[model samples]
Target: MSDAILTLDNVTKVFGRADKPVYAARAVSFALHPGRTLALVGESGSGKTTAARLIMREYTPDEGQLLFRGVPLGKGDARALRNYRSSVQMVFQDPFASLNPTHTIRYHLERPLKLHQKGLTSAQRQAAIVELLERVKLDPKLIMPKFPHELSGGQRQRISIARALAVNPQVIVADEPTSMLDVSVRQGILNLLNDMKAELKLALLYITHDIATARYVADDIMVMYAGQIVEWGAVNKVLDDPQHPYTRLLLSAVPDPDRRFDDVRFADELGRVEEIRTLSARPQPETAQAGENHFYRPFPAV
Candidate 1:
């Protein structure tokens, strides 16, 4: 994590009341390194989107700090804030909603370039836009004139990716980039994201509930529950031999052709779902190293 582009250090975001607080994110810490993807995985209401929002500056942290390139991101400095905004970009979950319905694909991609790269002339901006379209593997001539509605779900998602890349971002926070796409096209999008990370040397935070896709694209993985990262480590280490109960619970839920339907081990894990969740949600400040690259926050003693 020495070369982290973005770091969330014990960051917490709370909502509701002081008397009965709701922790959207509680002392959550993770780092995004250049040329690597760190996946944040959990079910809905598990603070996955909240963490993304914190990085995007949509929700300022109630506690801890967000660091950009080893410097604490402070709100007081206007120039620094502008630089942070330009450096970090996001690809939303719903591709259709992220793009403006009235604007052509060209307009959508061109607007970011016009705003961020103001020195570029109109002709130069057009060329840059075409380059971006090609980077996302789209035919610029055929897709540029079409509106969001005119493209398929997969194409629109590609446009979203193109727009995020338009700003020449150092960090790309993609929230469930493949969840909304057709199964047939999901792999293509995942492949494109992996390619972008390697080619652009971008630090990526890929958020999703799908462990399968996370394993496919991510270098490291974080398992979150009740707003806390209960377990995290190298993708294969965490997935192959999950250390935390919640991580095991999640992996068990994924379909396995080799495992019998009446397998007793999985059934036992499923039966204790509520019990495990309850224990895992409690504040556990203690972390134990499970392997050379694997670690988990131990569940608090009852």
Candidate 2:
């Protein structure tokens, strides 16, 4: 983590009334290193999007610091903020809604390049768009003229990836990048993300609830519940030997072809669902190491 391009140090974001606050994120800390992907896995309303917003600078952390290359973000001059903005890019979940309805795909990719990459001439910018399209495995000639609506879900997601890469960002915050696409196409998109990370040496924060896909793409994984990362570490280590109850619950929920529907093991776990959720939701400051690269925050005793 010493080579982290972006680090969130005990970042907290709160909402609702001062007297009765809702903790969207509470002391969430993680680092995104170059050429590695950190998958943040959780169910809906688990504060995954809140963490993405914090990284994108869409929401400022109320309690902690966001550091880019070891310097606190937003504390520097206007130019520094602009540079930071350019360095961290986001690929939203809803590909259809993320792009402009009125503009062509070329315009979507061109706008960022024209803004962040200034020296390129009109012809050069156009060529750059083609290269980006090609990089994402799309046929530039066939796709550039079409608007976002004209493309399928997978294609639009690729365009989103292309646009993020358009700025040559150091970190890519992909929030459920494949959830909206067809099941068949999900692997392809995931492969593209993996390819981009390896080729560009980009630090990726792939946020998703899909543990299956997280296992496929991530070098490291963090399991988020309520607003805290209850378990985290090497992808295989954590997934294979999940320490936190919430983490185990998530893994159990994943479909197993070999197991029957009425299996007794998962049923037993499901019986204590409420108890597990309640305990996991409580703030636990203590962390215990389960392995050299694996750790979990122990739930307070009931």
Model 1, residue pairs in steric clash: none
TM-scores of all predicted structures: 0.98, 0.97
lDDT of each: 0.93, 0.92
- What candidate 1 gets wrong by more than 4 Å, as runs, is 77-79
lDDT, candidate 2, 1-302, per-residue tens: 54888999999999999998888898999999999999999999889999999988878889999988898876567777678879999999999999999999999999999889999999999999999999999999999999888999999999999999999998999999999988999999999999999999999999999899999999999999888989999999999999999998888888878888788898878888899999988897898999988999988998
RMSD of each: 1.1, 1.1
What number of backbone clashes does candidate 2 have, counting pairs of residues 3 or more apart or in separate chains? 0
lDDT of 1 by residue, 41-157 (tens): 999999999999999998999999999889898775666666687899999999979999999999999988988888999999999989999999999999999999999989999
Worst 10 residues of 2 by lDDT: 73-82
lDDT of 1 at 141: 99
Global CA lDDT computed for model 2: 0.92
Model 1 residue 132 lDDT score: 96
